[model samples]
Target chain A: MAGMNMISAAQRFHAYANPARFMALSARLLMPLAALTALLTGAGLWFALAASPPDYQQGETVRIMYVHVPSAWLAMMGYGVMAVASAVALIFRHPLADVCAKSAAPIGAAFTFLALLTGSLWGAPMWGTWWEWGDARLVSMLVLFFLYLGYMALWATIEEPVRAARAAAVLALVGSINLPVIRYSVVWWNTLHQPASVFRMDGPTIAPSMLLPLGLMGAGFTLLFVTLLLVRMRAEILRRRVRNLRLAQAGGAGEV
Target chain B: MTRAFFALLARDLRLAVRLGGGGGMAVFFFLVVISLLPFGIGPDRELLAKVAPGMLWVALLLAALLTLDRLFQADYEDGSLDLLTMGLLPLELIVVAKALGHWLTTGLPLVVAAPLLGLMLNLPGEAYPPLILAMLAGTPALSFLGAIGAALTVGVRRGGLLASLLVMPFYVPVLIFGVGAADAATGGFAGEAGRQSLLLLGAVALASLVLGPLGGAAALRANLR
Candidate 1:
């Protein structure tokens, strides 16, 4: 189902990719996406704060899951977005794929920073320590954060647009291995962090009370990411257009 | 095809020895880093002995990382990389050859020198063989993985620092298992944990052997284009 959704999404990306058409479609998308994000965020907050019962063991502190878990999930998902777009850029030579990959990097890095910050926040009361060196998941996630910074640095250092895109595309593809490592670190080591309860094989172990709010928050975060992504991609396109125009003007001036 | 690969390998090996300051500088850098640890961390013999394995692996990583940009940047500047790319041998194979040359020059010397330096830290007598074994198995991975970053930033000016930043994250797992294997010998070399660490370290090196060439080749092509 995920694979199917990705293929269709990629098709939509390839279909109306003429920049003028994309701008029109994305402008239409912005308001609806923002509205949906707001709606989900409000409902999710209400349920998480008021409706969801506090854990008998964890008390009110478990509520941090509303922010922490979703941030972690979306952080990984953002990397997936970058990797997939990088592949499209490399293989299909889709005009917008590099833009998409470039746009996803800072947003993904922000989410990763959020995940680490919230995880540290959650850990303070839960584990009695702000950080745990013993935990593989935390360590791997830290590595992922650094990887994101490095990927962005690569793009920044390479001046030529085409060269930067291809070099960064390759780096993104290589760093994609981090996704699986972070996902499985909890399962493989099972250190201080709790094992994955929601995405398990025997069905979600959590009761209906908390899962509902978690799902809502997760949906809200995904929508927010897509919204932010569209805004950033539009900005990148405009930036490139401005650069090209300046170059053109300078060339004409030199000729005159 | 095989002849071309070996020729490239031989040429690189020669360059490393004759033109690129040889592998002597990396070993000397390794010694300096190891020597500075006592001053930096304070002269606590017990602590130095305890943390020697991890410290040694770290020094090895830094030394190898420092030399990585030289792998392709020289050929790139001299326009020889273009020749290799145009030759009959695939770029992936060329990457593999250069990576091997890198390992032979840099990684091998460090592995040989690691034991002598361990003695400076009052390292456990039992740890020597395991430390050598671990480095022997793991250091090639550092070279191979470093090739990817070297290739990525090949055409960029003064890209050594950037390549190091990019390659450091990829070096984590290798460092973990290498230090694990080297340190575990304290509990007796026969411990199951040491064996597992060495095995995993080897597995990582093998995986990098495959992935390194492929990624490095792709990055090289991108830069060359």
Candidate 2:
């Protein structure tokens, strides 16, 4: 039954919350994840730039959409992942949750930065301005970027890992709740940005030609997030191991 | 439980007033910030009047930030927060009490002082009532929401700046509706233009009232662990 399969899936998730298990699993996943990411990136880029037709109105500047839209989606997606990790860390005391959340911050920030940069570049040609405050999506994205910065800053400011993890988890949850409010506020206020075209109530308004490139680029970016997260989480685990080893060595010398 | 809450509230109020320069520092900062705006923006009375709602709200937010670190940091530093956490009353009540104390001390004064500052900015006479009403309805939300940031950063040394960075984004909704309400009041649109924004501001305040204490308490407990 489907319910039995769901239970097993939950079991697998809980099993991997163990750091040693997570380390071994992620090591296995990393190679395939990286290979898939590279393959997707190459194919996605080729299709987006070479195969997909340019926008009738936007012309070649629309190529930026291949990068911009996907990065923006990943930026939001990355925060969602961090928020879930925080929730898991708080509720289950999962050993790997904090590491997962912490490792994702810089990657999220980078994607957010890329989204903004590509957005500006796109806007400069299309809208005849480098930036537009009247755009709700852009403004909301900016706020999201600031949230990432604040989250990272909190982690840096606190010296104790346990204390920092808890505080950051609480913050991440609060930010997640506030995200909708921020988005709503921007939308309620005046915005010059075009309304949603891809994700709509009935169906996507975008043409299939544009949609194909967008979909491929989205998948590629998501794979990259997975590859980067695994690598960063592994590095974090090793750093903790080194710190623990150093402490044990110091304790041994003191015993003499 | 109610008595315990009130007692904690009173204790925080007294401490903020007595030791922390009588909660006047925030109002003073608010005053100074308003005074400096004319110099920076070049003293155009019309422009000042036009932007007064936003300027006042932004200054109020910054002034509120000046006092936020004091919300939990003092108790945190003196080991009292740990004791409070272990006390009979729940940590959530303590958070509510502290945020209420912050509102009473800092937020109320800023609301009280806004009309006077509004005059210097040449804010239209019709705008004053809504502006005051908006601030009164909205500021408790700021205090409560800010307490969460204060609690999160309480374990860090000299975390005042980080607290502001963490807390200010949360203040955006309040700022938007607060400014909107003031604008509606001044824009002279007929049939309750200002009323809608004020009502929305109240809704946001209510949501924050429920969420802030819970979130702040959770952060405090986490830090204590």
Candidate 3:
């Protein structure tokens, strides 16, 4: 009960509602977060490559899992962030939420592409085929990549910022429903892909030795996502500020 | 609402027909695309027949998309969209009417011309009925959903390409089901495939019937601002 209360209570943490406050908070956290991300990533990569043993059957190619798994996780996490930010923007009209969602898109898209690329590389070595449409997970992820591209394209193509944000919000909401569909499509349909092992009712099938590096990489990649999101958000805010300043200067000149 | 709906539909149809090369442009574009495909893939009757249903459906989709922009573009530009919005009639009815106009000009003509092109590709003669049936069930959904994209991009200058980008992803399920139904008919599984695809298409169309107008109205309002 206490845990449930705590979780519910944390949901009200709208501290970043104000853009200036959010920027200040993000600026202060950026350097420390960047350092932590680098350190974790370095350690994670070393552990993934050297410390972890190769799979009994798959051998050295199992190393691809380090990059592929984390990136896949981050892809979903990025969409989660966007969806939550959009909800906040829609319900509370938080200005920062819109910026957060917009900035997160390109970063998410890059992560999704990375996941797909690494998955393909990994698949080629193990499955003996470069592409497999029968794999529901693979196909769903491809669809997701397209959806991300479409959402970002919609944002880029629109001239008005607020209108673009609103439209993108709708797209984000619509696309988020697909995430679950993608996750389950493999299991529900008898596809070529293997079923979930790491996440299931039966706890993880991975041994602790491999699990350690995998967990480390997962954490490292999540931290890296935060760092990139902050950097992009700062850039977006600065860009908007410059535009506002230019508009204001023009307005003053008109008054003169 | 019924009276206003028919009024708006009639007005849009008249304007679309009266516009220089309006309906003809979409038909010509469709014909040109169909004609070019045979040139690209050297004329092989067997291969053409095999791929005919998909080819005709894709061409029809592209041609239908080509004219969807005009559904609200003229009204949006001339401020008639605002007039419609401010009138006593609901925007949903107006959206349905506009979609009907879009279909009358774009989809109906494509359906009429599809049989001739299908014959050129040597599609089995029996496939024509289901092809037309699928389009009859499917194209309304395209018009309804495409209206949302058109309304979303109403005021933008280079909105045509963006409209296609925004609308094409939504069109995938329609394309899948429409072509799947036709393919099933060719493969002699028409009873199951045709029913399922048409049913799914109808469900999508019905969903859009409610959501499309709301989305279109919101987009139009956003553009006005």
Model 3 misplaced stretches (Cα beyond 4 Å): A1-17, A182-204, B1-225
TM-score of chain B of each: 0.97, 0.96, 0.93
DockQ per model, Cα: 0.02, 0.03, 0.03
The C-alpha RMSD in Å for every predicted model, in order, reads: 15.8, 15.6, 15.3
Task: Tell me the tens digit of each residue's lDDT in model 1 across B1-225.
Answer: 999989999988887766435366687678768866754555455677898899999999999988888889988999988988999999999999999999999999999989867865667788888889999999999999999999999989889999999999999999999988977888734588898999999999999999999999999988888
User: Clashing residue pairs, candidate 3?
Assistant: none
Q: Which digits, one per residue and each the tens of the lDDT, describe model 2 over residues A1-256?
A: 9878866765677785778888888999999999998888888999899998877767788888889889999999999999999998887667788999999998998999899888777776655445444456765787788788778867866767789899999999999999999789666653334334322111236778877778888998999999999999999999888878888899878866
Interface RMSD of predicted model 3: 14.5
The best candidate in terms of lDDT: 2
Interface RMSD for all numbered candidates: 13.7, 13.2, 14.5
In model 1, which runs have C-alpha deviations exceeding 4 angstroms?
A1-15, A181-204, B1-225
Backbone-clash count (model 3): 0
Tens-place lDDT digits, model 1, residues A64-157 = 8788788888888888999999999987667788999999998988988788777767666765445433345554566677668778767866
Per-residue lDDT of candidate 3, residues B62-125 (tens digit): 8888887767887778888888988778776787788878888887887888886685566776
RMSD of 3: 15.3
How big is the positional error of residue B61 in model 2, measured in Å on the Cα after superposition?
17
